[model samples]
Target chain A: MITQRAANIAFNILVIVAAVFFALEAETFQTSGLLASTGLPSKFFPQLMLAFIGLCSVIVIGAYVFRGFAGTDKGASVFEDGGAARRGLLVLAVAVACYLVWSLWSFIPMLILIGPACALAMGVRSPWMYVSLLVMSGIVYLVFTQLLNVQLT
Target chain B: MFAGFDVVAQSIGQLAEPITLALLVGGIVLGLIIGVLPGLGPPIAIALALPFTFHLEPIAAIILLLGIYSAAIYGGSISAIAVGIPGTGAAIATVQDGNKMFKAGKGGEALGLSLTGSIIGGLFSVICLAFIAPILATVAIKFGPREFLAISVFGLVVVVRVAGESLSKGLLVGALGIFLTTWGLDELNGTERYTFGSYHLYEGIPLVPFLVGVFAVSEVLIGAERALQKLDFDQTSLTVKLPGWGKLMKMKDVLFRSSALGTVIGIIPGEGAAVAAFFAYSEAKRRSKTPEKFGTGHDEGIVAPETANNATVGGALVPTLTLGVPGSPAAAVLLGAFLIHGLAPGPKLFAERPDMMYAIFIGLFIINILMMVIGLMAIRFAAKLIQVPTTFIVPTVLLLSFVGIFSVSHSFFNVGVLLGAGILGYVVRKLGYSIAPLSIGFVLGPILENSLRQSLVIADGSVGEFFNTPIGLGIYAALALTIFGGPLAGWVKNKMFQRAEDA
Candidate 1:
């Protein structure tokens, strides 16, 4: 339900905080031993970028505060509706969950689950859709692990 | 610009091979299929196909990928004309006139015009690439770190300016992309920047995984939002009726102008087919005696954008092949393919492997000609792809990306990086930021960092010394004009408008 105005302001504010924090972290960057005196310090590029990012982020925040929008898209909603937000977030969760499943167990279970899980997250009620997804996952397994011999460990 | 006879012979021999020919055809077909589907574009299509390229010869692999690249851009018009939803961003400009024509019972004519315009555009750019690339390579061979720095800055700035409406958001993401590259050990000095105590990250983020996640996986998340809806388009009127020479002659100026405009825009780093399409579309409209006919199914309307979009393929490759700087986002991903094959795309590639360079030039020319035949045959099937549910595509693409990244390396960490990058892409995209600048920024980051630091040392820390070179200074001047020109022009136009009203 948040308009793009609120989102841009919040996002840019966070970006500013992160830029300052990371710029501070760049101070810890050092080249030890023989590389100590090599050219510019490693922190040079990162810190420069962080400062530029911070400056840009502040402008973005300022625009939102003053004009009620950061860009040309004025007072727009972030999502089309509550349903779209729910589905998008849930699909994202399914993706993360699929990755965790692979990391925790093995690629096989994750492969079998990823498609069905994603379909379910998108609110598919059709068993045929689930069945089609599982079949696709099977094809994927064969193509990569069997035919291509990628050893998807 | 011709290479030695032996180099051409070698390239032709390899291209004539049964496997390479088959892959070329297969690449185009696959590209058409993927491009017909909404939410998938050239970059993602190429990224998904990168894994399968491992087993092929270098030329074959490259041709396969290039086939995908060229065909994918062209393939987008099929869905755009038929379904009104563009299959790729480059096809968006085509949709307005294309769909209107289709709905007016001229679907076949619209498709044919797009097809003809695309082929003409693609072939025109290939010729330009062949003539122009060698000269550019020869000149670029003498370029130093400062020149590269200018090119990198030019590329990043152009992308940021065009990618989105908000300058600040684009800059933020562009800076973020560059900062991420600051991870891993510094190449200049053996300094660990942001490895975060992981041995795997010592080399920093892998390019293929990051790009795939950004384009493919993020699209998957976005597609998931409306997966329940099934796409439908008119199955009738799907036949392609190409324009005759009489009709073609009437719009020859648009074709040539759009091709040239597209090629020039393509040569500019970070400006992509999509930008070229929109630019050419607008230019055509502005120049037209019947400007009002645009967006209502004018044949020239269909021709201009389609031609420009496909022309960008060749235009984009010029900088990518000769300069190692990608000309577009898909070219950025294509650069990753070159890296995978132990080939670095730069001026040195032209000198070291003239055969490979000739192969690309010749192969792309063949691809354009072949697209005319194959595109017509595949139009019916491609139209059906527009009908596939988003739910089906979401899972298939997500799985493909997950497996595709893992297939590249057997490491879990690479897959993890893919997911992380995908999430980042999704978040930013949802926030109304275009990922073009982010992707290009990531591609150019290392070059920018190295060149800046190296030039700093070479100049003895004098900022003025960085632009001492004639080429570098010229580039900076162009960059300056590109940044300030639009605002200045708009201001003048506004003042003139006000004066007219006052009078």
Candidate 2:
């Protein structure tokens, strides 16, 4: 089980890295000579934001490192249990897969597959649940396609 | 300011049109249905419906969103009373006394009291909005870059401070949100910062889809986490019985104070219905003779939070409509709707579209009155929505968000952005960070950037010139007071008590 403090510290480290990378990238922004004479360069705001985010992230990492907790919950586990983690991570996987299916193939397949896939990921045992979800998918399809006249290819 | 009386008459006539009236009713019903579900609040409700408003006239579109905003705050109390699980954060304060009263067989009475209080508070705030918005707009119209920079800074700081237990975490995410907006072309200079060679990146981000993704898609992911969770509600205790004249008269002080407090709090940038509700609840408890009875099925406990949460609807619109600064997270999403309609909500909005202003003032009043009738009628059925299985809701909502985003622009990139924002929001939320500051930071990002740059240009590198304007200085003073006053007062009080004890 991952404690929230460890997870938060890790996330803050990633934020710091991202901020530094973006700040560096910002310095390479293409600018016209005339535009350079404006009040501030394009890199100015993004770099300022990056610096602020970096400062905040460092503060967070420091608090977590010293006190083992910084906010909200103190040293709680990231997920409730192994089962919950499995269920949550599985659902996230299913959501990502559905997105990929839609982008790669077609919306129809993704829409049809998403409902049952998510329910199965959550370990649903009831057949009626799947049936109900299908009906809901149908309703949504009709509402968008027929009523709203949206073309979902 | 009152020159819009004729325009007000015209707006009333326009609001009576069949389609606008139907959408108004539909928005409330939809609001109640969505609001009754645990974990889906006003921001999600408004975000989900924002895309469809693309085809609507400005008046009808805004009114639909307003109807949802007002009723969604009220609908949360129904679930709070019935299930002890607040449907929205705004109703968390009500769950203590409201659910207790329901358990004691006073559910109908509790429902009635909340409904009546919500209506009264909502009406009170609408009156305040009508009277105050124009006057503020009149002053705001004269504001330059320095003043806007002050307001934007104050908004971001206050939101971060109030949003979470750890200010650093909030600030980090808030900064991240603003940084994301610094993508595409710089409005001042044509330099591309983070576009990464994509034409879709030209707009930085499509606001409606991004907001929808933030609020709706993220909620779907969270709903998936507890997909197996089931709700237990007693249907026998679902009927509403409104408080009589005597009960209302007896609690008039609490009602009035909560309304006033909620409105004032709502006018402040980034403070939402939840803050107002909690503030009113605590204030009510402190002022009561039997403060100990507050959490134990007290009437004032139920009324104070319920009233204030609803009251925040009108108060939130004052800043959102007049200054282009959203007062709440829900209003932050609403700013997306306004922009979608190509109507920028600022002081110039008054001169550009007095008809729209009239529509909102009049429309909000009607939403409050109709919310009473619609809420009372729908509460019985709407309360059952809490029982809907998250197993199906998760996927269904995901589909809705996907389809909705795709329909908005016929682009797959937006759907990708939706997914990205959803994942970001889920991770951020699971880490115990509030999304309020992040969303507000995103909404206020361009303004913050533009105003700061313009102010710097005007100031010619002098820091003191940023506070030259009386309004700018006043706002900064208020920000200072908000930041330091509570802790300072507490410190002084402690010292005085220590001196007394030593003596």
Candidate 3:
């Protein structure tokens, strides 16, 4: 099991990185004249938020370093077992695959990707589940294309 | 208000169409199915339904969504009673007594009690919404930028406190959400904020796709991890015996008090149905003659939490419809549906779209009433709905989400945004962060920014002037009291306990 201290440290690092990136991005806005005349410039809110986040990241990291971890009971790893991690990542890969297919071929290819991809990810040995998934996908296709008359490019 | 009755009547007439009625029934049935399925709650249900509403008329679309919202909360109770696992977060409190009763061979009674309580709570909250929303809207009409900013601050802070155990974690996620909304061109100056020269980025990330991605796709990824685990449960007797008027009359005080408490809590910005349910459950236990029977499957225990949770549906809608600040995560998604239909929810909504108001009021009333009848007829079918294999549901829901998001914008870029948000939501959720604050923050982002900017201008850059408004001051004081008062009181209690122990 991954300790809460390690997780908090990792998350804080991510937050700090994101905050710095946003702070740099906020530098592009030119605060002048009417924009400045409005009492606050457009960049003020975003910069303030970025700074607040950075401050909070520091606090979290310090707390983790001092207190170790807050709620160890609920701090179980997402990957409790190897199989769970594999199945989970596989599902995500399938989603990415579907997106790729949609980008290349269109909605039809995406629709086709749904059943086989999810079935394979879930490790469904039963042919019946696949048949049902196919039928359900077809019904969704008909509903969107025929009844709503949405042109799926 | 009476002068607008004709328009209200016309909108009511439009909803009475046969097609609309059928859709309402269909939505409730579908909602129950989604809710009963473990890991899919109201937010996911609504997100999945968003694309289907694109071709619907405004009234029908809203009615369908409303039906789904109400029924999903109620549907969660079924799984809680049958199995120890709560189907939704709102049902978590219901599991203690409900599952106990089930194990005691009184599953039928537990289910019936939950059903009755849910309907009563839902109806009570709808009545509260109908009465409170207009009054609040009327008051909101007088609000300036300062007041709006105060309200937004109150919302964001309250949500951050209620969402997670760690306040910093909640605020961190919320700030991240708001910052993500700053990607498009500035509406005030037309200067690009973070639009990386992409035309799609010009509009910023679209709300519907992003929401669908966050709620549905994230769950799909999580669901994939545990899909192979079989849910084993024996259904010996599935009979439902709804309480008679005499029994209900005996518990009328509990019903009324819990409903009222639920509604009031719902009206608060961040505390949602789950909070209301737990609070009401604890209150009921505290007041009961025999509090020891609470987790041991007492009828009042079931009624209190079940009623409060269902009633929260109506309570959560008050701010969503009147102020555009969703009182819950589910309401946030519903708010997205409103934006999709070009309806900006606020005080002007009442003045400009009285018909829409009437539609929601009447439609919600009908949804609650119909929920009772439908819930009874569908209970057996609803139980079977949970038995649908995950293998089929996973692909079907994914297809729906993919097609739905695509149909809304007809843009592949929006689909990409949906996937991105899904991955982000999944990652954050796995890391022990609650999505409630992030979702609510995203919905409240523009309002927060616009109001803060406007308020600063109105206050002439004086920080003191920003806190000058009595309403704003009162709200901030109340928020401060809520956040700090808890820890202070806890400290005093601990000291007192130590002294007592020494004595």
Q: What are the chain A TM-scores of the candidates, in order?
A: 0.95, 0.96, 0.85
Q: What lDDT would candidate 2 get against the real structure? A: 0.89
* Between candidates 1 and 3, the DockQ winner: 1
**C-alpha lDDT values of all predictions:** 0.91, 0.89, 0.84
- The runs of at least 3 residues in candidate 2 whose Cα sits more than 4 Å from the true structure, single-residue gaps closed, are none
Model 1 CA RMSD to the hidden true structure, in angstroms: 1.5
Against the native complex, each candidate's DockQ, computed on alpha carbons, is 0.80, 0.80, 0.61
Best by lDDT: 1
Error of 1 at B336 (Å): 0.5
Model 3: CA > 4 A from native: A1-4, A30-39, A72-75, B1-3, B491-503
Model 2 DockQ, alpha carbons vs. true complex: 0.80
- Writing each residue's lDDT as its tens digit, candidate 2 over A10-120 gives 998998888888989988998888878778788888999999999998998898899889875786988888777787788888878988999899989998998899899
The sequence of per-residue lDDT tens digits that candidate 2 reaches over residues B427-447 is 898888889988999999999
Clashes of 2: 0
Clashing pairs in 2: none
Lowest lDDT block of 10, candidate 3 chain B: B230-239
Residues B128-234, candidate 3, lDDT per residue (tens digit)?
Answer: 89888999998888888778777777888888888878777788888877878877877666657777778999878888888888899988888888888777565
lDDT tens digits, residue span A1-153, model 3: 555568778988988998888788888976445655545667878888889888878877886788765444244565667777787788889998999988998777778778987989889999888788888888888998998888887
Relative to the unseen true structure, what is the C-alpha lDDT of residue B40 in candidate 1, on a scale of 0 to 100?
93
TM-scores for all predictions:
0.98, 0.99, 0.96
Q: Predictions ranked by TM-score, top down? A: 2, 1, 3
